[model samples]
Target: MTVCEMCGKETEVFSAIIEGSELTVCAACGRFGKMLRKPVMRVVKKQAVEKAPGPVETVVTGFASLIRSAREKAGLTQKDFAMSLNEKESIVQKLENGAFVPPISLAKKLEKLLKIKLVEFEQEDEVSNEKRGSGPLTIGDILNVKK
Candidate 1:
């Protein structure tokens, strides 16, 4: 029997995309990701196979350092930056501390305000990431999954 990828609970597993990876997980843990509809596969010739892998996207590393440097360079306190982004100071503090991944929306806001690219597309280089450290959960994190 399969188990939940997020919580290690044994139950019916559904294929879902959590963060960027696909996983088979229990219904409750699947609530942490987007439930995907099955994609129809068509058999194609060998030539098409070589072009299948698309561009790889990489998030800029040292995000916390980047945020802290930019904020300090702009002479904005964490509270001030948070207010500008409509986020809480504690969130900014956490982000600058590398406590979690910033949401795409927040990352975009930071890109604009901080004048830095937080994401980049690589045409050739490929990188694979496994699951990260288990961290505390929040309601919003759970609700983000398509149930």
Candidate 2:
């Protein structure tokens, strides 16, 4: 079985052109696009494997100290650094004091200016649902249960 590119649902899908992009989507999502081909049903499998989660970019620990030290070594005051970044001095002060966690965009800017590593990519482990089994059946599944 294929996964829908739009909804991330595992089911039969069809190739479609959506908003100038070609994507494989399920029936419900296919409505928004021009279907290039009809969905072909396949034998259902007892087990379905989900794709592993992608790596996430997160600000590193001790970011406040790193930024402060870098800025000091560069001989730039808080106001000067803020002006260079086109940001307010209060924002820079908060970042240096550990009172604020910079977003990805801000972190990237700091890394470029300070030449320090502030962002790290973390890989999340895949969770196996087989051991836990499926949770309580939904109303739709219960209604579809065979006698």
Candidate 3:
């Protein structure tokens, strides 16, 4: 069943031009506009596409302590380590304090420099039987307008 675009009534719809804009409205609302064609009833079909689980790289838990311990073991102060990494000292401090999460590139650099395992790969959650198709949404469907 198709719904009228203007009045939101579930009935047959006709393609029409109302106030210079096209709308799929019912027969009652169609009188407010110039009818373009015959009434149209749309049939929506949904198909589920299976998605394979993919590998996603993520930082290990307790990364801040791991990085701090590794850096301390390497006998490098935060400032010196930041200088060696070409990053701000504040960023290094934030990383050690668990306030910042490093991107993949930075994590790789840290792993190489500190000789610590920072990134781990895990399989992403697979999505099964997801619905795909629905009718076009009207403005009323999107926004809660007060009368």
| Whole-model Cα lDDT of every candidate shown, in order | 0.77, 0.89, 0.87
Candidate 1: deviation at residue 66, Å?
0.7
The C-alpha RMSD in Å for every predicted model, in order, reads 18.4, 13.6, 12.9
lDDT of model 3 at residue 5? 92
Clash count, one per candidate: 0, 0, 0
Query: Which ranges in model 2 have alpha carbons more than 4 Å from their true place?
Result: 1-52, 137-147
Q: What is the per-residue lDDT of model 2 for residues 1-147, given as tens digits with 9 covering 90 to 100? A: 789999999988899999999998999999998999965566787987866688989999999999999999999999999999889999999999999999999999999999999999988555544445378644544242326
Where's the lowest-lDDT run of ten residues in candidate 3? 126-135
lDDT of 1 by residue, 53-131 (tens): 5676566778899999999999999988999999999999999999977977788889999998887776753222223
Best of the candidates, TM-score? 2
Best candidate (score: lDDT): 2
Q: Using TM-score, rank the candidates from best to worst.
A: 2, 3, 1
Question: Which whole-number lDDT from 0 to 100 does residue 8 have in model 1?
Answer: 90
